[model samples]
Target: MSQPLSVPESHPPPALIVVMGVSGSGKSTVGAGIAKAISRPFIDGDDLHPKSNVEKMSKGHPLTDQDRFPWLAIIRSTAERVCAEQAQSGEVNKGDRPAAVVVCSSLKKIYRDILRGQHPASTKMPPEDDTQERHPSGAHIPATAALKTYFIFLDGTEKVILDRMSARKGHFMKAGMLQSQLATLESPEGEEGVARVDIDATPDEVVAAARKAVKDMIGM
Candidate 1:
């Protein structure tokens, strides 16, 4: 049998870890691996992209900021909702619900800002008490710190990325579009609560690096 992730001496606080990278950087693979390592639920952010966005990407066109705003909003909302649900259910989990992992290509810093609830330009912050806001399950949810986001960037060279992309199939993101994705990516360095790791390693090895980065950030 394969070995389980070794628990650190100190358990970390719950967090929303967004696995960020270009299309071929293995965001989904490493993201799921880290979720398993952390014993948390996994959410593929691509799954939440609007059909319009999907259609655009399928045609190999790069998404403009306008094209991305609505989609980013949805991803932010979904991440927040997951964190809210986990926060409410944490006690019931008896400390078992550590966190949630989001597999996303949060390419730019502005995009990442949107993911973390930084209001877009010309937008006002919502009022503290949003009476209209309630969980879909009809539960009263308090204001959430659930928007807290940390990025785990799966770094890779263009050659490696193109090779990986070339070997994959049945995806809307064509290997031809990799350069556009890489061009759109913003370096996560010096950003609050971000970790970057090279993906030029085995899947488990990549996950281990990601796990340690997450552990360090959350103080595991």
Candidate 2:
């Protein structure tokens, strides 16, 4: 696509990590594990969904874009707040780097765009990367280069995903919603700035894959 942005010598220590995938894809579970491995705070995107949306999903009904609008805004705001705070401390000059992992589903590209728009282009660089400069393409945009984000897509076979959904208890989204999630899911093809990994593998394997994917994507 536009010669994918090159990863720096060292990652800017991600400020916001959007662990995205269909329902039952182990996003929360895997997001938490990644946060733990990176030693950053993890925020659950589910918790940001409105109660009405939660109720609809709990009743086996899918939420419409309207239902998700506010939730998405809140999540984006949360990521922005984290970015603003990190920027104030002079840690992220080149990208949107957060102090902790704000775990989010970030289901759609528009959702990602919204979150990235929170911060201005002119911001401080992270502790490690001082050559912080925005890519020419994104100079005028709010999210342009000021935000350093990583999108991790938790992927797996239908059966594996269903099994995980079945085992999950007490979550607002029911197992029945799997079909809807699958229907709505837009796989993170090469266009999106995301790294994909299979969720069918063991937890350790998945985590290892995630780490390696991140390293490879950022050229660590």
Candidate 3:
């Protein structure tokens, strides 16, 4: 009889997992699921949006790239901050690497690039000593050069998402604005570190798919 093959143990790396898609595609739900699976904190990008942006969206207006840039910056900074906190508190994965999951509308390639720390616009002023940087939680913020960013893009037909949007209540995003989001979306099909998951199935199925994608990405 042939000997059983040994499977190598996988260790999770320091990473920022961004759950991205147009509104009504279930980013928040999927992101939370992924975060729970990975034992990391989950952040909703909508909460980071400026009051003006929320008001605009509440009034059924689509945000421009200019309006989104600042919001994207906030998202990036928040991810970094979370990773830093994790590191300081020894709340990391088995590999001793910090990780965080976030939900963002990151519909454009440029927006994704900013999250990956590849875009100049996402740059911030360098601290004199990154090791000494402090978060509001009193955690030390270290340099995040080793942190990697990944995206799980929830994709589905407009009709499907529109139906979902119609069913949702009290959301600032209107079902009518789906067209604009689709128009702004540049498919991240070939983009590195992106796992596109189709969201046309039931909520449980979609979350399972997203969790699989995240596990595949992190080798968990």
Query: Which number leads on lDDT?
Result: 3
Model 2: residue 175 alpha-carbon error in angstroms: 5.9
For residues 64-182, what per-residue lDDT tens digits would candidate 3 score against the true structure? 77777656665666677766657655666445557778998888888888777654554443332321232233122222345688999999999899777767787656555788889
The total number of steric clashes, by the backbone 3 Å criterion, in model 1 comes to 0
Please give the TM-score that candidate 1 achieves against the real structure. Answer: 0.74
Provide the RMSD of all predictions against the true structure, rounded to 1 decimal: 8.3, 10.5, 9.2
Q: Candidate 3 — which residues are off by over 4 angstroms?
A: 1-13, 50-62, 121-144, 169-175
lDDT of 1 by residue, 43-134 (tens): 88766656666778999998778777656655666555565456565522544434678987888888888777664774332322221232
Q: Least lDDT summed over 10 consecutive residues: which range in candidate 2?
A: 125-134
lDDT of candidate model 3 versus the reference: 0.72
Q: Judged by lDDT against the true structure, how good is candidate 1?
A: 0.68
**Which of 1 and 2 is ahead in TM-score?**
1
Off by over 4 Å in 1: 1-14, 51-62, 90-98, 122-146, 167-176
Tell me the tens digit of each residue's lDDT in model 2 across 104-126. Answer: 65666655655554332333212
Inter-residue clash pairs, candidate 1:
none
The worst-scoring run of ten residues by lDDT in candidate 1 lies at 1-10
Reference-based TM-score of each model = 0.74, 0.65, 0.77
